[model samples]
Target: MFKWEQLHQYGILIIVLEENNEAKWIIALGDDFYYDQNTMEPPVGDILLYEAALEDNEVIPLQYQKE
Candidate 1:
């Protein structure tokens, strides 16, 4: 939850890191469909850490797709 950059052609990229300062994840939006493929599976405590973009103060709106 620090750096924020705006892409010219694509969209925005939000970087989220793990507490151990090792594992990392990127939240990207625009021109892409984000969904939790394991929605029917068990919780691994890694929901937002997956594909779906995590919202912030800069997040505008999210178009939810019917699964």
Candidate 2:
């Protein structure tokens, strides 16, 4: 079972690396900002793939894996 959650306000890219007992979820946050008076530029962060863990069929926070 997988529960979807809103991670980013703009957009996101998801990719399932593996599907088994130990699965890997890769996510990439989009670099787009909404036009508003308070908001000027996009989010300050590198556009890269991040790994997310699963616990009891629930997705946890994003974790950066070095490999």
Candidate 3:
């Protein structure tokens, strides 16, 4: 599971790389609702990549959606 609280505590930025090579920012927050985060809006897909902000952090694959 992608834990926003855990990510936030480490000051990480979730970067989503699209097929076109563009990167989108993922905002993690404690709220259940997607609208609660000011930086990121709801994504329109089920699969994405989640990573930590550190240079040595590994990227984790995630399937997420707004409930």
Candidate 4:
């Protein structure tokens, strides 16, 4: 599963790629910023959700919506 988080209003972005079986993560920030699993260093809030999702085996959205 992959998720996108726009951390800044000025176009800063974070993209997370997940592979359940292999425990992989790739974080991308902005157009030229990319990090592999080893260098993936998400923010505090992001890490929280990431860890939760890993433990729960679910895809957790970055934010809640009214629906």
On TM-score, the stronger of 3 and 4 is 3
In lDDT terms, how accurate is model 4? Answer: 0.38
TM-score of each: 0.23, 0.27, 0.21, 0.20
Error of 2 at 33 (Å): 8.9
lDDT of candidate model 1 versus the reference: 0.38
- What is the C-alpha lDDT profile of model 4 across 26-56, one tens digit per residue? 2333233334567546333331134324465
**Residue pairs of candidate 4 with colliding backbone atoms:** none
lDDT of 1 at 42: 32
Leading candidate by lDDT: 2
Q: Write the per-residue lDDT of candidate 2 for residues 3-65, one digit (tens) a residue.
A: 344232233345444445344555554454223457754344334444555444443344334
Report the C-alpha displacement of residue 32, candidate 1, in angstroms. Answer: 3.6
Note each model's CA RMSD in angstroms: 13.0, 10.6, 11.9, 14.4
Clashing pairs in 1: none
The number of the candidate with the highest TM-score is 2
For candidate 2, which ten residues in a row score worst on lDDT?
2-11
TM-score of 4: 0.20
lDDT of 3 at 46: 32
The true-versus-predicted C-alpha distance at residue 19 of model 2, in Å, is: 4.3
lDDT of each: 0.38, 0.43, 0.39, 0.38
- Once fitted onto the true fold, the runs of candidate 4 whose alpha carbons sit more than 4 angstroms away are 1-12, 21-23, 30-67
* lDDT (Cα, 0-100) at 48 in candidate 1: 25
1-49: candidate 1 lDDT, tens digit per residue: 5333321222334444443344344444444434467686432322222
Worst 10 residues of 4 by lDDT: 43-52
Cα lDDT tens digits, model 3, 1-67, are: 4333333222433333332333323434322324336666664333334442456554444646568
